[model samples]
Target chain A: MSCDHLDLALASGLDLLGPDEAREFALHLPGCPACRAEVETSRLLLDALAFSAAAPAPRPALRRAILRRAQASRWRLPGPVAAVLLVALFCAALWLGATRFPVLPAVTRTASGYIIASLDPTARSPHAKGEVMLLPEAGHILVMADGLAPLRAGRVYEAWLLTRGGAHALGPLHLDGWGYAWLHARVPPGAFRGLLVSVEPARPGPGPSGSTVLATSGDAK
Target chain B: MQEADLPRRLARGDARALAELYDRFAPGVFSLALRRLEDAGAAEEVVQDVFFKIWHGRALFDATRGDLPAWIFAIARNTVYDQLRRRLRQSRLSEAQAAMLDLFATSGFEALEHLMAQEHIAELLAALTPEQRDLVRLVCVDGRTVAEAASLLSTPLGTAKSRLRAALARLRQTLATEVRAQ
Candidate 1:
């Protein structure tokens, strides 16, 4: 194939080429320096791009709309209209409120894929700190501490990665309140396996430092 | 995801699909925009606009038109080009000032490309507007930060940021094209 045709063929969908066109494009690769270089570079870039690694973005709105449209997804009653239902619900609510009702059941959100854990504890009498919130796909993992004594300003609560073998210092998480200290950890491959928080100096290294303030052990959950 | 499946979800106005698509390419896209626009604000605005359009376009996308990434990239490229044309027509920036805006606007992924390219970063300098060429000489060649470059140019920080981002994204795309041509 000529260089122009060869280039056009390469950019066009790979599936569309007949055997001859595909073969002709490959033949041009051997003799043409510019085209050969172009082919190799494009291949490398596309390879590195990991195009197939893309995952489907969850369509929450679509799910909601689908559920709304599909009548089986929700229960609906047609009869005595909204006024009667509102009055009945209001009466029930009032009766419950007047009788010194028990506290309402805790409504908590369920999260997908948690880091589950069980850990070894030192016999030394000490309280372990705990915190939780949504984490992004990247950046420093923010671990926090709360309801604890004020740590020295320069001092931070360092987080640690625990293995059956030993411990690695994650990093010092900045402390905000007795109820809040953030352990900023660089997420490494499998680093999220098990985490321990330590109150180390404002500067902490790759291994655990100072005392363990809050600790958690988790398996993939 | 199966090409057939996305349209159905999108038709229902599923925002999560938009998020998923963003997750797949947004970093590179944003980084590309940042490289061109230099200012994070402009680059971010472009990225957000692209996704917002996709989110609102739930029922509009057709599976047979093209692959999503290339389509998205084309839209992004057009958006950047439109911004450049709009700024040039509206602002009347001087040649010296415009040069500084494009120079040093790139950071995040040019750094990554450098790491991956085995020291062969291709001819980035040759790909520039004359004004951008001057900015390269003054800031990058002289090691000036955005603040330093802005002070030297006697321009507002906002203008500098926008120009820098636009320039960087252009340079990065140019380099990407050149690298592909290798």
Candidate 2:
């Protein structure tokens, strides 16, 4: 069924429609499949034409950075479900052990020195919540998270230690079956400002290159 | 490492498969990004994002939908749109320019048509008459409005519209056929 708005739809896809025509087409679009398909096909064709642009090789540093991150994540957790389960159990045991050993002076002294920061969800994942236990004296930062959406393929949950200097990657957070994950990383030396959990590529760039899923209000001094 | 096995190997978290994929598609990805973004650094970042997503999302690749290159370019297209959106958001543009961007903001749809079109962009352009191709280049690649393109080409507004409409219709029909054949 050819609509009178067909020309307007095609022009709209090419971004050639004037404001008045664009608004008119927008109103007509939801009701017209033929015009909608025309716009969709036009956009796809233009997207494909974009590929014909001059191809330049990426810098070597990018390749190295991506591979390095991927390799690090691969080695950090080698196996499948069994390995993840083992790591989860080990983390639980460590959390349990740390809490149970109250008499040890380092644990005791660090316990008082630790700053408990709430990892509040950002707009990206509103229902998600987490907490970060930053024990600077003990040289440890423990992250416990719940209600994280399962990551899309080619993505992972990464923790970052945000300082005035910059955001330093803590590591990838591997959640178990129940949508919960705990990450225990040695607190790197910095005047820590906050903690962030972002959905990053499995091979993320040098900084946090994804949406901030959970973060603390930058007061973790 | 056969091309056919790349998806499976990548899905299994094989770093080598990722390297291979990057080697194969990074240049095209970088080119597409650089063309859209016009900033080398941003383009490089897009390349990184594209490959990273490919590696992590390997499990999500459905061979039934299209081949690896198709999937890679689809991701690249979306990533470039993201970079463009980010740039627009960060830059202090005039209201008119911003409104113009708003018009083009709905340019994120991807399909098998793009994959088919990507492989045959030159051929597809060749299929159009010289005048139609020039009109397409002016309006599509150069990002000019149809009226502006008509003025530049010294063609009548009605003639330019008909030529462009016909040219686009041909390309769409050809690509749709290619998609169905696949």
Q: Using TM-score as the measure, which candidate wins?
A: 2
Displacement of residue B69 (Cα, Å) in model 1 is 0.6
C-alpha RMSD in Å of predicted model 1 compared with the true structure: 25.0
Q: Per-residue lDDT of A80-188 in model 1, one digit per residue for the tens?
A: 4323543453343233222211111111111211121222222221433343221212212334343455665687665565433356554455433223344323333
After superposing candidate 1 on the true structure, give the runs of residues whose Cα lies further than 4 Å from its correct spot.
A1-221, B1-4, B92-182
lDDT of residue A184 for candidate 2: 56
lDDT of 1 by residue, B53-99 (tens): 34433223444543455445534443443344335535754442243
lDDT of 1 at B125: 46
lDDT of candidate 2 over A1-221, digit per residue (tens): 68787767656656556678878877887677777666766665765665554344678888888787667555444557535644554453343222222222111111124344556678898767666654454445567676799977989899886655567676788664445565656543334566789989898777898999988763211
- Which DockQ value does candidate 1 get? 0.02
Worst 10 residues of 1 chain A by lDDT: A101-110
